[model samples]
Target: MHCSVVADFFSILKKKKKNVFFCYAVLPQNIGTLHGLFLFFISLFPFTLILTTDNNYLFTKKKAKKFSFLVVWVQFFLARKKISNSTESIMDNAPAPSVYIKTSPRDSEVEKAQNINSATPFVTLPSLPVPISRGQCVVYDQEVLICGGLYTRDCYSYHVLEKKYKKICSYPKDVKLRGHSVVKRVNSNTNDTMLLSFGGYKNEKKHTLTMKYVSVWNGEKQTSNCNQWLPLMDKNEDKPIIIGGDEDDYDGMRSVIGGSNNHLLFITYRPKNIDVFNLDTFQYVNRGILPSDNWIYFHGFVSKTKSELTSTSTEANEKKSEMILFQRKTGLAIEYDEDSKSFDFRKLSVFDDMAPLSEYAHVCINDTILFFGGHGGPKLGVSKAIHKYSLKENTWVKFEHNLSTPLSDCVSVLSEDNTYVHILGGFNDHRDEMTIHVKTKATDWMDEKEKEKMQIYNREKELEKEKNRKKLQASHFFCCCLFFYLCCL
Candidate 1:
């Protein structure tokens, strides 16, 4: 009966006998181990296989039980080998590093000059808190303050020199203010670093009434104790001539205008007027009847110029540049000259080509204004183009490259090194998520065509992996067979 069983196993092996040697190595000797001498030798076979290199004993009847044990051991070896090879192949096909923007020095000569001019190695500041979205940030001496922002109610203050957020007393919880203008009071006899906060939404429902309050923050304390919110006019009037003081609070705060000295300026969108306040006395000076444009959002920046104008009277007054107003809807600038303490109101020539995507895209970097990333108009689909407003030339220059992704509500700031624009917290197209982007050089200002190419390259690599998958499977199978043979000894 034992001999008959051996014959049946040999028939099964023959039917699958591509590797006859490997099949034979698993077979027992053609005799029963129940015989006393064979049983003794069968118990010793595993030990002999462990110590000896001879292959002749493998075919003996006494080695049958040992051979069967060896075959079970070789199966585990083959399975382990198959797993290792497959794991190795998978690791080799992993994805590349994700680098959407890479910035290096633009000019070799300029880099050399910077190296010579370097007084100390610069330490970068930590990223801004609240991740600014469509707000205004201003720096004066050592303190950088952001005021009147969207999405966030609390203001942020950073000490640029020390790289720390100043611990200041908090304001009243009920006072929800934003979308306002801030101006640094440089010429005040007592306080050189006071910011005048004007305009922005005040309450729950979006109201058309202009907000009449002005807030002052001392740069040294960064404290609300030193900060005070004062109303420009009486708050109880039915048609209160304020930016965010209407029946309900919305439509954002008034746009701020900084003067040559201690006086501050502001304008309303609904009632359409301008108002001024003296920083020293907190006096209200109303300037009546602004331009008829209703859908305008304006901002002001101080520009001082001392020049000799040769007039008929042969008398020269040092003419400081106008506190410029940027009209959001029109993309036009209205200049308020200091000579008359009134707006010169010149129409900035807007070419049909110069319409910015929206007011949200406009940002001020140092002396220049940058505009980009707009929703699609009738003709232009969601523009990724960048436009620069040169304060010196009073002209716009279009940068070559657009953003890597189409995003709005991004926070863009010039680094303390003054070498890079760090843009943070915007949408990421590749991941279909919101991601941070730090724009370090001129190349980053460009369009998205380059980033799209790298994305396409990664997809092709995945395709190549699928094409070679069959070859990988065959390689793993051979490795399993070889491992099984090694274990059989």
Candidate 2:
């Protein structure tokens, strides 16, 4: 909280030279004004400061509580009534330690444009089924599948078009997993592909966690029943965890990241050891040992094009798919070699200009990736910046921020039509509670390449939906004809 407060103060201080003279003043006349100052002073105490500034932009390293405790103040000479005005007072969306943005007494057009861009509105979506964090969100078709999170045992499917959600059933008994891997099964029934959820940090009773049963969701089913989920359990010593356990996916094959068993959510080990778990046979067919790199934490993702394209989708796309993995200091690109059926790894040349990313959330629009809040530093603070990284350029290019404190452990998903990217559900760095933060924005920020590819995908999805509609209409007609023929007989 102090970290955020000090940072806010510095930003406010640097915004205008006018506020500088008043920084040291104590307004005792008004109790409210004095109180705001009191909290402002309070923020200076708990911070561990190593600040870097260039052209008035402040970068801080104080960890804890994500971004919390805003300190908003305005012109003191304003009448009390005017002081309460929305512009003079705290921003409605920003919470706590109120900080009102004060510009120079004489504002220029450029400053006004910058101000307008700073306050760009965040996307608003329907309320979540429940406030959740440390959970996983899978962009399944036109719907979002939200799995377990802190203090929640239920699952939910959020429909994008309808802008509503319904409970999708819960884990059996007391099963709860804060961090778990959710992946679409490669091969499945003709109706639709199924989704598999397994492995996690310490969720509820860590002792009860085992490879004994993997939860399965039938995407084609509409009803929410525990019976609908098939239990995938072939008990063995492997115990749903290898080299501990985590919720990350390896080539969309296994659920193991540095986060391991015993509720260990994020470990920094990427071992050379590898094992294969056959979804069909439910057995470890082969095992091979995995990267040396020193990243306190890291994140991995694919471009939007990678997810949309199939092996034969395009002739130019020779490599099947690519995953970009980056740690605090360096990045590695993992691509699958079709001929060898093995992954080829190499270092990414660029260094991320943004803050160190770990436990961050992102959605790829075209070839550009927009990264949201994550652990800011060693202190485990949260970052408010929404960073943009281009796959083509392989570099961090731009950034935005939320109106309020940033969240950690949040997840992001793209709409089926590629019109919007939804970022949802994260917790404060200092609290156990889940923050109800969900935002949706149109893909206007996406690059031209992504826009074009996504437009094609959108058309394909529309054609498929149309074909399904026509098929349904034909089936209904056939049923009616058969009934009339029987009556004539």
Candidate 3:
């Protein structure tokens, strides 16, 4: 908060130097006014610091209550107003036709153009549904299947297009999970290409061993069914995390003959207790563990543009698709050595220019592993700038975007084309509560390219809107003049 305040002060001072100097006129009689303003701002600083800083105020229930109330009041007065203003201050529509597609550089030509872009989005949520789960959600086939999570009890699934979300019917009345894996099957021969949900909290009890279940939806019958809960092949031991689960269709006849969709890789927290489970064969093979905690936050996503384009609808045109696993907890990278037999797990690096990525948020698109806002340093809430790690270049590319406010716990999801990453819901330090934050502009490399086009288009639309206003005024004036002339005649 201090850093943000200082940065803002510098920016304002730079832009309005005269005004800043004028403030210096807080001399003599105006000294009282300056002092009062300074005192007011000092008082406005959040009270949370008082708890951590002042030992005298620590460990008192009565004082804590008072401090909590003070913090809430400050957020209600200052932060809420700022957030509310942001929604109305920005233009939420696509750039006007004149701005993006202009006839000439002339102001008149730009101004005369009409805006053809729609303000309404192609998709809109009726209401932000009561989010049931958090960490690593999966959108399989069509429905978004969110498993056991950091928050909430029963797991739930929501249809992306239908806007309908209900508790997972197959999910027992009371079951909770943490560190689970959810994968979607794509075999065309079988009728039940179900959503494979594995691991995490099976019930209120926090069990180290991971569990597995599959949910199947019948389009014809319009009824959903879930397979019986299947425990891992090796369940006696603790910390059995089912990290990666995907059909190995690459090795030609090897995958087809093996029928290996449930090729599960299980990991224990210890240094060397990794095991592989081939559900089709009902066999468990011992594989050495990874040196680092890579598989803990690893996410396996099948890319569609490389050699193995299996599940995606546009596979034919897309040419290739490789299963991508992202290891966020370790760093801005993915390690495959312990899991995959072929490649030795190397730190999958990205563009160096886009340095210091957020360790928390990352997503896979084709050959790119995109990361967004996270606490950069050891400090609990000190998040760095946004970044994208391209698998193609094996390097990082810095993104040009600044959040309205600092936040954490936000989630990102890619649309079908993987063009726009829709960031949603997070906790802000200012508000100190969970709030929804969406990307208003591009956070990718092409932001500068889009910015130029948007500027020109906007100027044209403004001019066109102005012309319409003038025409209406002229028509009104002529009508009044003719009426007065006829009256005189």
Candidate 4:
């Protein structure tokens, strides 16, 4: 009876393939007692066993193989069950993965989308107090200050926030400045902010190279309302540093590039030299010569430090500054590496065809450089074209939206936020101020539809001007004919 019971237990172990070693080891030890053997086999809990006896003494090859197979099979089944349960639980609780399908839109649909998003770049603003051309315009405390143009010493400040213009103190009558470059500077020692007006055409023919520094913010005042212009006098020489020379050598058509804590840099045409003015000692020093002989008709200078452009926080603390110069006439861009103290000139391929134009107003904001209307291009008279050059892409894109009025020799100032470019005092019959809301992302560049619109606008303006011109000519002819008739009688 005991033997049959043992045989039945073995059969059950084989079927279950679990607790084979526990039963096998304990049962062999208690085979002499039927009840002990039966109780041990019945318990049959899962456990590992180390047999001290030799393999040949313990069991035959067939029995050992069976035991090994049972152990592995049981472990495999248990592991698979655990894995299956985990997978099912995850699938039940987890969110479904997202899937995207892309489709291309039709050309007409794309154009319509662009049209809905696109905006006219230029907006006309209120006219200045008086019509002035080739003047100086600078932004201070959200107000634009305009001064000294068309042989007038009158200066006015336009509050951008209020959209109002108020007459400010003018420069002295003796100091006549137009076609000059004005730069705002801060004194390191006094921490005073000042405006320096330098190198301009004065008295029509005379080129005044003298500089005048006026305290814009002396900590006491918010604006340059009652500030007096102080001539930047030489310490040793006790005289004004005469930058203007012979009209042929230096034509006084100059633009202020950028300045450091110690020196201010400016570019002059005719002679084509870069002059550095020592802010500390108040003296002039010639830095380098420009490559082109043609006057720098339109020029912009911006200084960028490595820290500003760097992405990594570890390298963003670098203090290296680079000065970039843009010459519109030749489409030459030159960069001065502060570390190497060398200039790298890069020819912009996009502006190759548009280099002949001059007198365009340009301003650098962040990485973008915008060129407004100017004269002396393929589009004669005043150019209604607006060109934008991106520094990051090193590419030029012309905007389809032109200025409200075609203008040249306008003074442009970027707003404090850099969103709007205020263009003031261009060569027009009336002094018209225009604001250009620079688009962060432009949809199209001079599309066919935009071109047609610009052509129609220009044609209408030209027709009106032609009618006025013909009437003036007829009046002059009649006067001459009447004068001749009276003389004859």
Q: Which candidate tops TM-score?
A: 2
Clashes of 3: 22
Task: Give the distance in Å from residue 295's predicted Cα in candidate 4 to where it truly belongs.
Answer: 3.1
Which scores higher on TM-score, 2 or 4? 2
Query: What TM-score fits each model?
Result: 0.46, 0.56, 0.45, 0.55
- Report lDDT (Cα) of residue 192, candidate 1: 38
lDDT of 2: 0.48
Flag regions of model 3 displaced more than 4 Å.
1-127, 131-133, 156-167, 201-275, 291-343, 350-359, 377-384, 402-407, 416-420, 424-427, 430-489
Query: Residue 31 in model 1: shift from native, Å?
Result: 99
Candidate 1: stretches off by over 4 Å: 1-127, 159-171, 200-257, 268-273, 284-294, 298-321, 325-333, 337-342, 351-353, 361-368, 372-384, 391-394, 407-489
Report the lDDT tens digits of candidate 3 across residue range 1-489: 000011123434566632221111101111133333542443443222222111122224444445554563353234334433443222443321211112334445323322212231112233334443234355553445544444543444555434456555334434344444444444433334444444433222322122222433433233322433333343445324343333211110000011133344333322223344454344555444444453333222333232223334452323211333333433322222223332234445434432222324455554455565554334445353566655545555665554545555455565432334445444454434342424322224333543453344444444554455445434544553453334335
Per-residue CA lDDT of model 4 for 170-231, tens digit only, reads 66666556445666665544435566665544224333332223423222443333354556
Q: What does each candidate score in C-alpha RMSD?
A: 28.6, 23.9, 25.2, 33.7
- Rate residue 251 of model 2 by lDDT: 18
Highest-lDDT candidate: 4
Scanning candidate 2 in windows of ten residues, the lowest lDDT window is 257-266
Instruction: Give the candidate order by descending lDDT.
Output: 4, 2, 1, 3
Give a tens-digit lDDT track for model 1, residues 382-487.
4556676655456767766566556554445554333444454433322222333334442243235423432343354445544454344345435544544443
